[model samples]
Target: MADRQLRTVLEGGGFFEGPRWHEGTWWVSDFYRHTVSRVAPDGAETVVVEVEQQPSGLGWLPDGSLVVVSMKDHRVLRHADGSVSTYADVTEHCGGHLNDLIVDAQGHVFVGDFGFDLMGGGAAATASLKRIGPDGSVSVAAEELQFPNGAVITPDGGTLVVGETLGNRYTAFDLGADGSLTNRRVWAALGPEVTGTTVDEVLGQLVVAPDGCTLDAEGRIWAADAVGGRVVRVAEGGQIVDEVAAPAGLGVYACMLGGDDGRTLLMCCAPDFYEHNRAPVREAVLVATEVDVPHAGRP
Candidate 1:
């Protein structure tokens, strides 16, 4: 297949990352703004949760509850109805800020931490990947990630792929029924310079579409590249087959592969650099493009 591309479905921001499609809308997290937004099909956006602690990753539970990774605070927040509360506690164990996450069909939330203060508060290779059960129990899943960021459980829930941003590749693992990971290996590699991110932001992590990753029904895994200035698309075996350019300097963060026909590409874009002295902004764009694939995972 030819490489996929995207147009300006929308724009404007200090930075943007993490695009997830669920319940008829594209949900994204604004890092600097510390808010989670829901976007409409025509590019309109509405902020649903204004989490002050730099929200990055998002997930859902079997009962329709929402969970979010608060990067600055190192806690997970669970949203039910309209209220929020602690979903899991990891401060005493990891002692690092959480970044991105991927929830499996079994109600297990896999989360990653920075390991050290990357923005300058501290320095240590403490990066790791952890997991949280639906009942609020937290546990360690993997240790010593270079920089584990975006992640996803394959369509059949058989494998979990994590984006090691610093390494510029996707780390694949065999999934267990109990939500544990095994046989750690590199499934896809994106050389430091090769990406489709807008702006100068480095391509941190990526997501795999649900509808086709396992069967080829549109089987594809897409990464939200930061420095490459676009979203890069890959086939089943993990190859950079194509890319979609955005106006935002190629600092693409994350994306979702789903829409009405199960093929809309939703993205969070920024012009790179999170404004002189600030962190990246989670900008907006309702529908980045129409991919030839449908997203896997929850509604």
Candidate 2:
């Protein structure tokens, strides 16, 4: 596939992640800014809420309430009618900081965690995926995951695909009728998983570190390669069919297939991401490229 041209849609962000198109608008979170915002088609940005801890993922509940992931505190905050409250707190269940999340049509929120002290330069450890039900019940959805970063649910809500950033693959699970995750398998192995490798060696050997992803109508996943500096569209069995290379000196962190027609591939780009380097200076941006397939799936 030919490399598509990426155009900056919104700029001057501390670090953007979890891009989603909902209710005819694009929603995202800036980590350092501790805010969730909505971006208009014309590139205008409106802050939906200011989170004190930090926000990563954005989703909506059944009654039109906004559900956001508070990263540092490991809480899901629900905003309804201009009011904010804790939907669920998973601090005790999560191994480290929370990363990203997706809410199903039935109001089941699947959240990921860091599993280890990433910013503190700790060793890589297995993580787990947690699910929060509508009634504020929390449980471990799946266990021993290698740094699950982003996830998406099929339109029918039958399957959940998650990007395992450290595992170098996209893992999948069958969503049962009772909200249980079973039949865990690798949906796509973008690269080999290096076991017993140091964190630096593992990072250096990754061909494509699948960070965040969105699904298209044809069942293809457009995933941002966190270390590869590109957003790749992968078909079944880890085959990369298309891609949009990031600009020089930038790393692609997250991506979503959205826009008026749903063909715009939105990518989050930053100079670098670390606890110390990323500040409120707004070096990150949301860039987009047009594709042939339209988006189809739940955030």
Candidate 3:
């Protein structure tokens, strides 16, 4: 178990999310900056691609090229050998803006949508979990999800788990060979879902706004509690087994279990998440803390 002590890995970011540790570096997306960047072990950052429509989730293809979620346009963009292009267009199939995504070993991508106009102020609505195959074809993997965000696939490739932010729980699905998701069930339920427009009202009802998360070698989940300013490691049954809180004025928007040995838990800290507030500032930072469990599973 770790405490609240966290050290800065990188700073001056504009609302970071979708962190992935791959190929000896940390890749993440800056929502406001509209860029996907990679941070080295020594905290150096290099912009991989500048997405015009805004970038959220990040993954890679089988050919080692980068794939990013274009949030506002509801598209997935691929960057290969220094060129960016559309990999899939999911606008007609999606209700709202697209969020985070996970790419399996076979290059199958599972992505989530917002379901409502979150930034512009809309009522809570159900969303869809979409899957994009290697051939650039799209399909609805699942539906009626309440704000599906971060997602991860088990190392054995048998299961896929996603964080439903508004639902206060993580949902699991059986991943079939044909890219179909089945056997949907609640993997962890921190609290019941709450519907509200104001921040206080929504926060009051949520036990934990489970945001971006990563899986550890022990089969546990390290989920960022967006409203609680803490990153909690939850066991299979939704029990809070371990946690690490951020300092005042900082909230953990996303997290990844990564490092040379995968024992480092990287926290994406930001001052706030509101579009009006966070879009104008560069107060976000990348912080790291040592953990006992190393990482396991897909991006």
lDDT string for model 3 (108-151, tens) is: 99999988888877766779999999999999899988789998
User: How well is each residue in 1-299 modelled by candidate 1, as lDDT tens digits?
Assistant: 45555656556544455567778877777777778878777778798887888787887887888888787778889888899898886775564667777788888988888666555445435467888886778888888665677776766778887777655567789989888899998777555423332212332332331111111145556776655656677664567676777664355556677667767776665555343444533444333677665666432
User: Per-residue error at 100 for model 3, in Å?
Assistant: 0.2
* Tens digit of per-residue lDDT, candidate 2, span 2-117: 85787889999999988999878789999999889999977899998999898998888888899998988999999988989999999988877898998888888899999888
TM-score of each model, in listed order: 0.82, 0.97, 0.96
Poorly placed runs, candidate 3 (over 4 Å): 193-202
Better of 1 and 3 by lDDT: 3
Q: Is candidate 2 or 3 superior in TM-score?
A: 2
Clashing pairs in 2: none
Give the TM-score comparing model 2 with the true structure, all chains together.
0.97
Clashes of each: 34, 0, 0
Among all candidates shown, the one with the greatest TM-score: 2
